[model samples]
Target: MKNQEVADLLREIAEYLEITDVPFKPRAYQRAALVIETLAEPIEDIWKAGKLEDIPSVGEGIAKKIAEYLEKGKSAYLKKLKKELPIDADALLSVGGLGPKKVKILYKTLNIKNIEDLKKAAEQKKIRNIEGFGEKTENTILEGITFLQKTENRISLGFALPLAESLKDQLLASKRVHTAEIAGSLRRSKETIGDIDLLAASDNPKRAVEAFLTIAAPKALLGKGEKKCSVILTSGMQVDLRIVKREEFGAALQYFTGSKSHNIALRNKAIKKGYKLNEYGLFKRNKRIAGGTEDSIYKKLGMAFIPPEMRENLGEIQLAEKGSIPPLVKLKDIKGDFHTHTIYSDGRASIEEMIKKAESLGYSFIGISDHFGHLRIANAMDEQRIKKQWKEINAVQKKHPKIKIVKGAEVNINKDGSLDIPPAVLRSLDYAIISVHTNFKMGKQEMTKRICDAMEHENILVLGHPTGGMIGERKPYEVDFDEVVLAAKQHNIALEINSQSKRMDLASPLAKAAIEQGCRVSINTDAHYPDSLEFMRFGVGIARRAWAGKADIINAKELKQKS
Candidate 1:
């Protein structure tokens, strides 16, 4: 899954092009980046198959660049762009509202080349005096810089997961490694991670370490040993790989993939059962009893195997002991995703492309839930546009008969407990997902009432990203979620487990609480593009971590037509 690595390079190139005022190529590179990141298979594998141009939005020109990246792990065009700009694009982009254009202006006008310069300019009121930047924008830049400072060490799971999996896959392919899996917080599917931990088993530890170094192509080596190695990835993520014997593999993986508290609980349980537990194996009077497999160790402990995500010492042990750990929802349980966007609104892809991607995912149905009404900034559809989209959907359905293309709209919950989309227009929609797009500073009572009011409307299937939390960007808005959950249960509105990486709102704990209150949830990618539909597994991960079952998820069943 060099997919992420290549996508990042393409995005970097796009940023450079945008800064240099290169027309059209920037958008092409941006689109290609999205497609690559969302690819189902590894980009390296795709290049190996000699079908680079077969990728959507990848023309002959982009294909050559991708091939270059695949072969040399560097793009000549990207290198040229970097030589031209010589600026840290990612640092400036991290500011809330700054884009490449603004970055260019800052660099050209004020010689603000990095976050430090930008921060100083904002603090000294120099940015506000600039032509394009205002006082408010200056204040926002300061706030964003503060946020970045607080979270500079934390890496979003969205980036870490794919990059870690790519490294894991590479290790396995080397043949020196018998098995390899990413461990640590990444394995638990936390929204943000610090670093990556990989555990593996191999007959030849020295060969495995050498293979990892070759595959990583690290920017710098932190440590290297026969059985243990550490390096810094190009993405600035630190990866530590450890190799062990085949017999100790499971225990080693479990040991490394720990929440710390879970291992403590397990060790206590092992002691009570007259067993000594460590990375080697579960031992009974110094005689190794179980270690070959994770399931074997769990079975020896008189408990069911706990999922890595649920190993947070969050009441999982009791269920494992009862041998009735609820059957957590999986990605395979998803029948369809009801929340998606297209060119009708702010989405990157068109309606047909979205439908085709859904079909490729073998979805029974896919909802085109574009922004509607007060979301004018997103180019949201009005009555006429909604009807036109319905017609277009009707026509597109003819070409794709295997999956049902349900027409839906995402509406904003007004502060006065009303919906932006008129009820008359909503009736024509197969479903409506309501969200908090504005007025996020409302008090808890007001926010809860607003969300509950909208859920009372018919065909309102989901409360989209109920918490409105964006990882490292925005905190969840103040809302009485308990009250909201009660209302959802009363009205049968499903809580959404939005899996947008940065916005996995109605986070695991909230989803768990909703499920415990007998309110169903719908795990959706909230995909803005066909490639991002790949985020469904991350949503499912949240559900599983919350101990949700297929029955607890609404889209696990067939979708019925609205009208």
Candidate 2:
């Protein structure tokens, strides 16, 4: 929550600066915002350690603003911006095609202050009549509104997971919780989550519940009970906390950390063995048999313990019964990350900082796959710049002897289905990732063929964000997964499970399907900054849910040996 609070303020500052015609300052705030949003550690902790300036792109000024906000409950600069602009920059900026300039035009010309106002303007054809906005742009705004509306009530996993974990830590810190675990879809690592569920076993349930309410400082209380409580957080996210005895903790967790169907199947299996399964315990005719642990219950029921992410009742139960559950890819199993960006592109951090961070993580290698070719919006590098970067990388590699820094580029696949980089240039690099940067409106056949045609290039190592789905925002471009997966297999290109919170592309099911078809997939953070390197957890989680073992992940082994 603290991280997001800071990130939002940074983003708002960026939007306001851009709206006011300030140059360079807007991108600075934007870069800082990206870093904070993707950080694995809590922002408050960094501030408490007096190391805010150490964060990527956070200069002394930005650090002061962050520290000021952390100390006080608000940002004075943001407050001043709001007073001057009086515009809902956050809401307006959320619309896909609307930038700060467009937002300013809408606000000044049409009195459109927020998403609702913009929607009304678009619907009434008022925006199209305005200069610069034609029918196409206005129509796109309406579509963005519709897309934004669909994501109401649910929050992205990127935001939800950290919030849940932080709350759980607070509970433990209160010295009231004996054991606590997050449950529900949040535990399952779903791309987007509705409500957060946390279960705990406490010696003093009343005291534990009281401490939780105080730490959470909920916006509103929904209900109250002896050991259970529900409240709305400041972010308007619903969180539920339940306390149980230590013996029943595992049982309660197993019951509540379910996908309904998985639980139902478990009960049915227990019934066949003349046992009862419930939140309390698995019981015989008169005595308790298993309840002390989740594994105990599964073991008693004659099945292997299923991982929480795989408890979706999608053939997992059958596999568990057969003791054939595959060992899913773990975060620790990853040896290197291939799809990272640095300052040579639009990334916030420099190449040296990225390498140092990777080294700190004990990574054996890190790929500097900055944006390349004609994607000008990304500040892509040309051939000369690529050559320059390689020299810098070569120099940096000498200093970091333990880690192999590979020079790579995230090349764009043009409309005509050819890579933007020349063949000669592509042959000189460690690797290249082909992605669709424009023309998302292409039909499925055209889009699939375009990507597949690009896949034929021998220089390509991976298909970056195969589906290009942005969670709760832009839908994936039209493309048949089977054909794309087939092309990837034929071309020996690994599909990337991009781990950006907003773009957990290669959705778990599709990733699983690709693996089932004997195609290897790479789990990458697609990190734009050093801190975002932590987002690798999201990709690993998705891969786990996809039932991918370490062997199924490209980065989990020696890179050259995989292909």
- Global lDDT of each model? 0.87, 0.89
Candidate 2 lDDT at 301 equals: 89
lDDT of 2: 0.89
Candidates' RMSD to native: 3.0, 1.9
- Give residue 488's error in model 2 in angstroms: 0.5
Error of 2 at 33 (Å): 1.2
**Could you give me the TM-score of model 2 versus the true structure?**
0.95
Score candidate 1 by TM-score against the native. 0.90
lDDT of 1 at 116: 85
> What digit string (tens of lDDT, one per residue) describes model 1 on residues 70-136?
8886788877877788789877887776988899999998988888888888888998888878998
> In model 2, which residue pairs have backbone atoms overlapping below 3 Å?
none
For model 1, name the residue pairs that clash: none
